[model samples]
Target: MTTTPPHTDPVMHAIGLAVTEARGGDPAAARRALLDLWERTGVTGDPLHRCALAHHLADLHEDPAEALVWDVRALDAADALTGARVREHHAALSIAGFYPSLHLNLADGHRRLGSFAAAARHIDAARAHSPALARDPYGDLVRGAVEEVADAIARRDRAPRAPAPGPAS
Candidate 1:
């Protein structure tokens, strides 16, 4: 007898396809696809899909500033979800586990925009929410990025400031 694979949410499936397309070299197309999905979902879509779409959209932006906007939206969407809703969407996933990555992305976006204080705040949030596992590749990547950004901020602080030019003659 033939058997079918387990069911996955259609929204989640579309997100996976869009993300794959984005990674395959047509970011614009991927962005368009995601936007379409977002419109279809409207304000009442599952929080999980909203969060995932916003997160992916942030990465597709060319400007870090624009990316930050999407990142904030993603965080807001995630925050709107309750633990039970999260469990309903994906039994294996926890809402708490999503925060670290969201914060890490925010930190990176802020760091790219030279907002060291904001970046540091998000980095701290990421650390606070990170899983206790000894070795998660995603966690390690986020930690490494955090360290790099921290060092960059430190160097910027230590660098001598150039004297401001007086009024033009």
Candidate 2:
């Protein structure tokens, strides 16, 4: 049975609290809490912390464009976590585990902005790098999100576009 390191639990708990607050209709408070956590982590903290912070922050933004910025940052931070870097915090950390969710979020963000091509690319990446853990709820969630985005894209494609206006008279 895999277990999260004791040291990482506090951070995870804090993130969960912030997420709950956001989902409970108090996004402003959630944003402030996440921002505070981000500030505490700074640039020199563990890559995992930065990745988590950026990922959660992305969800707080009402604008898809702005959310995409945070999603990209989360992916960057996750990608930068080498074995040595990850060992500093989570000795048994599987860096590959982060890619699926990060890519899934990016796909959703891109889809929201009507960037179907970019969204498809990220969706493929998510599928390719998905974690192999058994009964991982987060992985299931990512898979569901990928399907949702794909469906949205399909619906958009089937939508008829209005004719373009002629040049001014």
Candidate 3:
């Protein structure tokens, strides 16, 4: 899984902590915590929680195919999210801004699986929606990832990206 670092909203504090744990090198503990939260959230629960949980969970997996499953779930939940709902958590965020990273992660996963056609399609979507990203470091990070994934797809490289959060173990 590859995406820009996630944005933390006050309402998502628990998730933020688990994500921090994942980044801090305790993936097993983080995964357990996240899964517990996922259970509480339920399958048809809040789209925001579903999106964030699936997105972060995807990055904890070492298998590309497994990561892709969570990425797809994240995208599905993202599609159900609304701007109003996102704004409830953080006024600075828009649902549109989430697409680039979501698509980027999917692209990277597909690229690693040798699904270049799908990878190209998703990379194109990521680029097309990238202008919605803020003119800040967060935006730069996602855009940079978009470029890297695109490059990898163009070269038909299936090897994982170095230091990639998931799909590299």
Candidate 4:
């Protein structure tokens, strides 16, 4: 038998309110609400709330590249954050896998920026992070997307580098 911490409920309720606001077309307000929740709950190390915050940040960004930064922050927050409060969240995500989504989104962002090497690196990270991604229901779509991007990066790399664009003749 297991029991949830008392603080967990409050944090979840606050996160839910933020998400509801974000989904209801007021992302800025949602972002503010989540930030307040972070401050109130001191949820820096709680993987669930950190992931939610990161997703909120990503959703608020106009640029995919900016969103990638938030995605990476989310991963880092999960990886480095420490506290008894987050143990269950970490354990659950470890069992479920979290890295592939981070790497795939990062790779997609890098691809959009024409950063082939970076894109490939993140794709490789995605693959390395979740070798059995194809077998995981939650990771399958990201895995497929990463495979396509990886293929595109390989093709791009094999092609000769074009002459740098200069002033028109």
Tens digits of per-residue lDDT, candidate 4, 1-169, equal 2546434566666676776776677878987887776576454556666765775566566676786777777777657654454455333334225677677767766776678888888989888887645475456666766787687676764322222122110
Winning candidate number (lDDT) = 3
lDDT of 3 by residue, 76-148 (tens): 9999999878777776679999999999999999998999999999999999999999988778888988999
Which residue pairs in candidate 2 have backbone atoms (N, alpha carbon, C) closer than 3 angstroms, thus clashing? none
lDDT of 2 by residue, 139-161 (tens): 57666666766676666542222
Off by over 4 Å in 1: 1-7, 132-134, 156-169
Q: List, residue by residue over 1-169, the lDDT tens digit for candidate 1.
A: 2222213567777887887787777889989999999999876777777898999998888788898998998998999888776666656567887887788778777877878888889878887887632356655765665566566555544222121122110
Q: Which 10 successive residues of model 4 have the least lDDT summed?
A: 160-169
Give each model a TM-score.
Answer: 0.80, 0.76, 0.89, 0.65
Q: Relative to the unseen true structure, what is the C-alpha lDDT of residue 54 in candidate 2, on a scale of 0 to 100?
A: 92
Error of 4 at 106 (Å): 1.6
lDDT of 1: 0.73
**How do all the candidates rank in terms of lDDT, highest first?**
3, 1, 2, 4
Tell me the whole-model lDDT of each prediction, alpha carbons only. 0.73, 0.73, 0.86, 0.64
What is the alpha-carbon lDDT for the whole of candidate 3? 0.86
Q: For candidate 1, what is the total of clashing residue pairs?
A: 0
Q: Which runs of model 4 end up more than 4 angstroms from their true locations? A: 1-7, 38-48, 81-87, 90-92, 132-136, 151-169
The prediction achieving the highest TM-score against the true structure is 3
